[model samples]
Target: MKQDHRVVRRTAAALAAGALAAGALAGCSSKNQVPSIGYGVDAVIASYNGGSTLGANSGAAAVFSRVLTGFFYTGPDGQPVADTDSGTAKEVPGDAQTIQYRLSPEGVYSDGVQTSCDDLVLVWAAHSGRFTKAGPGGPVPLFDAASTDGYRDIERVDCQPGSKDATVVFRPGKHYSAWKTLFNAAELMPAHVIAAQVKIPNVVTPVQTGDQPTLERIADFWNNGWKLAPGKVDLTLLPSSGPYRIDSFGDKDGLVLVKNEKWWGDQPRTPRIVVWDGHSDLKSKVSDKSVGVLDVGAGSLGDVNLGGFRRQNLPGRGVEQLVLGTGGVFGSADARRAFALCVPRQALFDKFGHPDYNVKLGLGAGPLNSRTVQQDSVYYQAISGAGDKYKGGDATASQAAASSGMQNQTVRVGYLEPDEQHTAMVAAIGDACRAAGITVIDAGAPDFTASQLTDGKVDAILGGTAGMPGPSGSLNATDAIASLRTGAGLNFGRFGNGRYDAIADQLAAEDNSGTVLNLLTEQENLLWSEMPSIPLFAAPRTIGFGDGMENGVAGPTKEGAGWNMDRWVLKR
Candidate 1:
């Protein structure tokens, strides 16, 4: 069913000479003050202080995450670096799993330090694994375990030292496969730059008194390092294998992201990206100007009807999920199926600003919906014998639940209610469930904590998988599955079908499908069959930029380092 939603987001446009008029040209010689040329979309609201900042705000995290090395790099024309996601990019079987990587002989950070397998080892450890001050307990997962030479995960380190192809390998526990399926989007960091500092991609004030932890120390010498904070935007560019390098950045003024002059591969279509700081309004300036700065803003034009602009029709990357938990507080399969049928997907769409905001409330991330468990999944397909009775609310068929040994209980639902966005959606889904005869007992707040799960009030929870570059596995199908049955996971709903879990386990250990996807169509098919968590919608990435600011500023509806901010230009 197609729905036209009115666009409610405010918007504006920058009219400049036809795109062909602006091309790449270098200018130098900064006087006392840096003469600047700017663009239209640079105004992003700044709230919260650093690490404790809004965790739900991916808009900020996406930009902050880019301050250092991007997880994976695409080519000048948006192509993934050749073989970047090769064998080394396999899944692990256990949460204690780790994957090693070998750098290409040619890999180098912007600072000229050659990238290596060690960097991957230490960096991944820093983000989620142990090795830093924080031990590897909790939900933090690392890519490489003990990143010593000839390590478990790393195959080779490429040129400089540990650089080499097929040198790195993943060393996840037996269940590592399940974990890998859930967390493939995390970018590996370079530890060389972060060695002496207490943290990799160190945030917060550098330790002035205590001796900073060295690479060796982090590797073996007590793993003494600083705690990482998401608060600070360390513009300090160490280096990276990705296309663009960080030229310079200020505390709050924003970072100037220029193309890597030393970039070894084909030059990027939009070479330089100058990210502006903070969300501000310079309306008149944008309309009357032609300068060297490609703008970064969040405010729309005062005169332009933002309503029309939003309706202009665009794509997005907002991910939504329906999770089922073993809260045991909920009903059995029969009851769950009844609840699923009652979910008002249509109303949920209507409330979130359809077409514009709600866009396509289609379930899950994969083609069939939820990426982790798909329709064709061996697990799902095997479970398929359960039949359509699970999806549609046919009384006669539901009666079969009694005959088939499916339970009859109403599952309680816990959902994320961190802010306005979460509240509305949760309410809508609740209404849907209410119509279906299932009572959606409000656990209160959309930002549901893990403790909520153990409390067992949550039969189902609403959440989303981290956005993957493309439609692939369940963010980490095996891990997502493991999370359901064994290890703790974002899958607050402890949903596990025996057949599906087994297939996911096998698929995780071996990428027989020839893709890095966690949630493939098979998984989606599985979700459709199981309806553990009803698939809700595909998340959209909103990117908006000045129309004529740069020659090739072509990007998504919401502008940022993620898209065409690099090739943008200023009119003279």
Candidate 2:
């Protein structure tokens, strides 16, 4: 999971509040001392939904990615590994397109509900887009999934309750490259919860158009009702389907998780885990030895000492890009391209990039970085030339803006408000664009809310999308392009191009590594001309820890520092 500046600010605020609360607790009573149980990790506890910004950005995904067992878990080497501990998914004998899955007999939710096929049905409904469209000609999805990759290919799902057995039939000739990674590691939540809340007659069958009344009710709840907070948590509704259960929560006190007694696997090394949303000051926290681990991020206490604690840089799997909202001032490709020229990428880096990392365009290409993309590829070579022509503050952009009839355009630039990094970056962009006779208006929002993206108010935004890197160096190139398509979940900019969509679809269908890379680079070249987005610098993964913490692993991907929390230990 990756995010923009708003997420970073939200995390800081939450952690700061938690720290204040911890201080208050200490002053109030003798029993207020930190618990001597499981090793603690600093995190921002936000919304619980796996598909939303709060889940993806605030490190809350770990509750689902690590605590709840998925069908397969992504290993340390960036490859999907089968999670035989939870279940087995195999191809059906006579049906090459269908896959069958059977759960481990010991698999059970924290509430003692046996893991069943019904849960898989819910996941299928959410990801398959079956319950996303409400009526004829409706453009917006009722339930917006995070990634509609493999699930969109599922044609049918047949599940038997109590048996924990199910079959998923894919669309004819639809070969999903990420099939193994789809459901293996995410919590599908419990089917019975939705069934009871929405008044559904049966929980095992695929939800269809006829069930819109009940399905819409379920979608509404799934979208917002499941949010978690200190005193506002609905424990009965958000039961865990994995190894740990939420024990308590608070706005300032932070969230706490305990080992599930019904967990069938090896007991977690730590008995209880306390997650502080914010510690007032990292330096003080380390000085007092109050925090066990600190999950530092970009622009958060840059290059601060850990008071003898260890520091390790993790593999970051995302990039920061400028997404042009094609519906407003940037409706013209020339306009978008001219504006891209004024994005002072280097200046923004000068303001924010520090001791841990530096800012570079990740090779003047698409959102795919050099880690998974070949710098010498034809596509990279092509886009690099185009990118160099702009290079913020260059006179070429000034002439281009004038020639393109955008010299005096007032482009509203939205970003995360109250974010120091975004404030500085936007200021630099304003200065650069003003030099080109274009005005950059601040239409920034508080956070990465969906409403802010699609309101058709802002002309452009400084944000990013999470990338999927493969063990074979094949980037899920289509994911970034797909976000610019019509009816795409993350297409907040209202940008769409039929020709680009056709090429992206082809790229999505390709499986060969070399072929995928070729198509990816080609598609990036095409998008460069359209300029729906300008690839910026790659986000760095740097985290700080407290003394005596060991084996604290930041997963090979951008899932975040908490992904491998179960393996972290404290040496006394």
For each candidate, give its TM-score against the true structure: 0.53, 0.80
List lDDT for all candidates, in order.
0.36, 0.57
**Residue-by-residue lDDT tens digits, candidate 1, 458-480:** 66555443211111122223223
Tens-digit lDDT track of model 2 for 1-572: 32221233234334533321112222334332233323233233556666543444334444455566767654433445566667888866454477888888888877777888887777777767656554676645667665466677888777765568888888887766556766755446577777767776555643734476677777777767767767898777766765567777864445667777877765655656666543234444545565566544355443355655555543234445667777667778998888877777655544543334432433222323222233434445443444555456777788889988889889876754433455666777888899889998776654434345467767766654422111011133323544666566656666777776665556556767677656666666667778777656544334544444444544424344455554445544
Best by TM-score: 2
How many angstroms is residue 2 displaced in model 1 relative to the true structure, after the best TM-score fit?
A: 36
Off by over 4 Å in 1: 1-107, 110-112, 123-166, 169-186, 197-319, 328-338, 346-370, 373-422, 435-463, 466-501, 508-532, 540-543, 549-565, 569-572
State the number of backbone clashes in model 1. Answer: 116
Model 1 poorest 10 in a row by lDDT: 3-12
lDDT (C-alpha) at residue 413 in model 2: 67
Tell me model 1's lDDT, rounded to 2 decimals. Answer: 0.36
